[model samples]
Target: MLHIPTWKRIVIWGLVVLGLVFALPNAFYSRVETHNDAIQTIEMQGSTPELVADRAAWPDWAPATLVNLGLDLRGGAHLLAEVQVSDVYADRMDGMWPDVRDALRGARDRVGTVRRTDAEPGTLSVRISRPEGMEEALRLVRALAVPVATLTGAGASDLVVSGAGDTITVQLSEAEKVATDTRTMRQSVEIIRRRVDEVGTREPTIQRQGTDRILIQVPGIGSAAELKDLIGTTAQLTFNPVVGRTSDANTRPEPRQKVLPSLDEPGQFYIVESTPVVTGEELTDAQPAFDQNGRPAVNFRFNPSGARKFGDYTAENIGSPFAIVLDDEVISAPVIQSHIPGGSGIITGNFNIEESTNLAVLLRAGALPAEMTFLEERTIGPELGQDSIDAGRIACLVAFGAVLVFMGLSYGLFGMFANIALLLNVGLLFGLLSVIGATLTLPGIAGIVLTIGMAVDANVLIFERIREELKTAKGPARAIELGYERALSAIVDANITTFIVATILFTLGSGPVRGFSITLGLGILTSVFTAIFVTRIIIVMWFERRRPKTIEV
Candidate 1:
């Protein structure tokens, strides 16, 4: 019996207390603001560069662990996505061959029947480019305003040749650089969240959880179709020429109306800039604030070219309203008061606190580099999370008490030593989880309970082995020594196999399952140490000091 010093016992108990202090705050992972009794944020208005958020309404502070938790545990939205890999190749070919159109145009004259599709020269639509003869067949197709149409074969010679892939280099370019931005997936998830938040939704969870998938879970949201619209659109941001008051008549009229919400309001139109004058990609920051007159507004800053173009447009259109359109909606039409130099300006509109916060989040996320298709979406409520916590607590209490009773009944006084070891094992596990800031879900709780059974199994195996050795005429001390030495191989073999499965589960499973695997892995490690070391120390101390007569049964 190796008695632990009083100081060692004190240190062990102190560590257990310290662990709880760190783990609880990390479990919640949210900071909500409630105005009066209702939820809200600071409502900012026009022109003011800075506005403080509502301190009284906001949560006291941020939590320690910001890890994403299971939707059922924390109440969030889940979205599954499918990215079209073929579209990636098509977009790449678009930039690589600007001269392909010239070759197609030349082919139309020679081929008797040639048609040009929107598909680039070497892509899925190259058959339409017949280089031998086709002026008669392809000439009338040009009259159609449609983007792409297939041509019929009306030629004696139809040559369809494919590009030699063996000669093609997988070279990257500036266009590819733009297409493959690191935040493209993050932006799409954000856009979907913004699209929902635009309608004033709250406490949404949006995450890029897979190689090419997004998970969004919005609490209290019953319908998610609107989210699909936001995620699906490319939301390409660009600078276009506003049809200034003087140039309105000169602008070419399209079939579409000016797209104003009210008939009485002045019409607004734009000529898409041949190349984007500046792109939203350069926007570094945005914030919601208040103006001198006190209306909701957002302040924004642009890169060099965007600032130059924005200043020029304001100067040219002084005293006339220039529409700030976003995602094709006329968001605001503030009259140009003066040239906005300094690369910064404010956008003013009739907005509430919800609208202001949402806009700020959207601008920060920016637009996705390409389109993403949502395959599935799910939402989990907070009520379910509470239910899970209650169930987990009940299961743990029942399993732990059952294990304690079984160990005490079977081994008598030796069971008391094992129980203490079990207690210490749990304390160490909790302390490690707290320090690491690991998330605990229902599955994770189950893993801990499973560990209790495994922990007792180690002690029970050793105790039964000692009983068998004593029956074979061995002394009590010799029996105890033989029991521990012989049981070591079996315990190691059993735990090592279980450890392998836990490792695989942690590596392959998603979210909650991974949490379960982590807890199980940690428990296996601590359980082996406590079952072998702590229990042995107690049993050895009892034998040495009291020289316990016959097994205390």
Candidate 2:
């Protein structure tokens, strides 16, 4: 076990030196981080003298990555939101109304004139003028049903069509409901992530909690309320043809149209078509710009399909007024002066620079499919986070000191060798964590402290084995070799068992528990390398130099 070749010794020392070099940058984390940020800014924009000086403060070739502090370590916001998935089901059925009407209208002679009636939220109820043609009406509606493409309900149809008396009801099938819920949840997560990312904040945790809830954590945000405001908006935008303008708030709109209050003018309402010409889902880009009147406005461009539809609509309806609606309210009503075929348009609203900029961000991120209700919200203060970090640092230092003193006193020079390995073990841990940019939480600090003590256990076992070998009539060299060889099995068994436990904790735990498991697992790996491989190298080099015949254990 002590017969390490020259090549192996060189490789082992090389790794230790590399770990120390990587870990050294963390000792001056603030300066290194500032230098890294400066370099990134220079790369993105033209570099100034001040930025060049900041970049020169730290070497670019050195590892600049630092451990990411978690929300507990850095002040941030936490919010738990439950998505209203059933809302999508209702919206889905409502959207299908036009298709259903057109299909049933094709067979008007047999099914008779059909009129829609109010039913449950997710059910579409229609009354046929003729009761004798109910069977034919069922066949027509059934023909519209398409198979659901999901793992659980792959072969089943997406819609359920049932009829009783002259009334026919249409609703999503069981399989379709599951598929819709899954899709809604996925879209909600993606939209939320995009919206948060658009704010240009640092790393944010956006994870699905269960079937209906999402857990969001954003470090360095001011408060939960601020984060909620950023993502709470549905930002639904639409353009509809204006049927008429009205002064009365209670004025009734015509069929297939609705009354919405103007955002700029108070108490002014416009009756516009409920069905939109185009939705915000087609918008590809939006930026804040000045309008023809030099007013703050939002400029938007559409995707290919949206551009085609919008172009056709504007070309066909010249000189007619259309309303730019946002979140159910008409933001502006502008008359179409000429054919707009470019697919780009400007929205003039009563908006300041900030409002225009925010609106542009929302448009660029797209709209959420459904609304969300916040179940829990919290804001951690920076002062408290700093206190926790200070306490953790002190605890780690104290634990490290105690372990080093105990190991040095118990095993003499060999214990000192173990202590050197233990120190390097910590450096290696930090090096690995920095390389991966792992988030460090309060519990993670505790895991590191625990590892300090555990790291010395292997050294103690080996030292005791050497003492026993000394008493059994053996030379110093032979005793050292036998000591390491005999202790190898026990060291591997103990570390492997502890490693398995750490793996289990990581797999089953969440949040802070997961942070603890990460450090514990990584500490085990680094400690084993330093204790077994590193300490052996140091002892062998020392023994070879001294050539001691009578060694004192």
Candidate 3:
């Protein structure tokens, strides 16, 4: 009557074996990590003798999935940066200048000669020669305004156009500014994430904090300064028509033009158009390669729209030079030798292999929306993390030992079976975590210690019920069956309520809090399985072998 079917027993044992196998990689963390990294490198860059040796550190057939260590458990960099969202407003006004000029020129008969005037940042102003044409100029400029593309800003114009006397001023509306800030924050977060992920760091947290701030935590990085250098490079690339080359660093350029120093030559500057013919935003792919002269360079390709524009520009101006600018510096200025039809080009400079590779990585990750000012930075050392790990380990060991002794002393042989199930419960928890690639933090270890204490609750209930049943003069097999059946409701009720709380925590929390929820949620499932099925199966098997007339609780 108190027996499990042979097929059911086999299925349960099969799952236990599979879970433990998946969890085996965590026992040899460094070796499996090396093997995984080596395998990834071989796939990306091909294998060398050293890489081949590292790849063989772990067997090919074994599961290589590992539980990632969180930033608190590993040395890393942490930064809180405030995005300069106001910087984009000036660029937005600059972009709208051409449209404003063209609109005003369409009615030149009445507006007379139109000229741009110096205005404050985030605002554009233009002066007309004839004062009587102010109303016409304002009307023409206002026609360029479009509805803002946001839910709350629906039907509101993106630009506010106004005129006084002979001058007309244009600026972004308040609704549009709010929308722009949201977009800027989203783009900054995504770009930072891509830049960090390009270096293959594990479990980096790049999240938006408030209105214009971001929090970044990267594990296994050298320091905060190194991380800042990686993500801070704007990598803004543009191809502009070169106006003239100059040796004077203080040379002033005409309107809609800028002077930038050359990257390869010292004290040499080039004046180029302010507006670019093509930008890095249109780039589809970038890779490191060698030029025809065997020098390190980067090869980049543009999308279809960019390809068409580039081809037309090259075809029309076959002899003119175009400056390739990166972060406001002229990286290269090559004259068009012939009609270049394809959208692909090579960027050659005084670069070695490493610089070329880094350039390619940045280009592929795309440019940041705007600059960021680091407000706070901290570098966590590995020594602190090791101490935390040691403390957590000692706490877990103590909890484990105390639980095993208490269960063994209370329920005698049945209590020993409960201890065995508790061990299996922990193994299954780690196995699940490994399978899901969950990151472990200090709080997550606390959750595991809590799980160890809670894991024996079901066994206690079942044993007490068995004692009660034996006192009623029930047979041994009937008492065991009734004990498990009576305890099932209480076990499910208690674990289900706790699991709901864990789910809520996971849904609403971030960082270490989320890590704790992950372990707690998974521990509940594993504990339930071991308590209800595993320990019961072991007890039933023992009873079947012994066929004892009266069993002690």
User: Among these predicted structures, which one has the highest lDDT?
Assistant: 3
What is candidate 2's lDDT per residue for 456-506, written digit by digit as tens?
Answer: 888888889899998884688889989988998999999999999999999
**What tens-digit string does per-residue lDDT give for candidate 1 at 56-99?**
32444532432234456655556677654445554444433323
| Candidate 3 lDDT tens digits, 1-553 | 8879999999999988888988889999999999998987676456799999999999998999998888888889999999999998998898788789889899999999988888998999999999899988888998999999999999999999888899999999999999999999999999899999877788899999989999999988989999999999999999999999999988999987899999999999999999788889899999989999999999999999889889989999899999999999999999999877789999999998778888998999998988899999999999888898899999999999999999999989999999999988988899999999899999999999989989998889999999988878568999999999988999999999999999999999988889999999999999999999999999999999998899898
Best-performing candidate as measured by TM-score: 3
Ranking by lDDT: 3, 2, 1
TM-score per candidate: 0.60, 0.82, 0.94
User: Candidate 1's C-alpha lDDT?
Assistant: 0.59
Of 1 and 2, the candidate ranking higher by lDDT: 2
Name the candidate, 1 or 2, with the larger TM-score value: 2
Can you list the residue pairs that collide in candidate 3?
Answer: none
Tell me the spans in candidate 1 whose CA falls farther than 4 Å from its real position.
1-7, 22-69, 72-78, 81-238, 245-275, 303-323, 333-342, 370-375, 378-398, 420-446, 461-497, 529-553
Backbone atom clashes (below 3 Å) for every candidate: 26, 0, 0
User: Relative to the unseen true structure, what is the C-alpha lDDT of residue 171 in candidate 1, on a scale of 0 to 100?
Assistant: 27
Residue 488, candidate 2: how far off, in angstroms?
A: 2.6
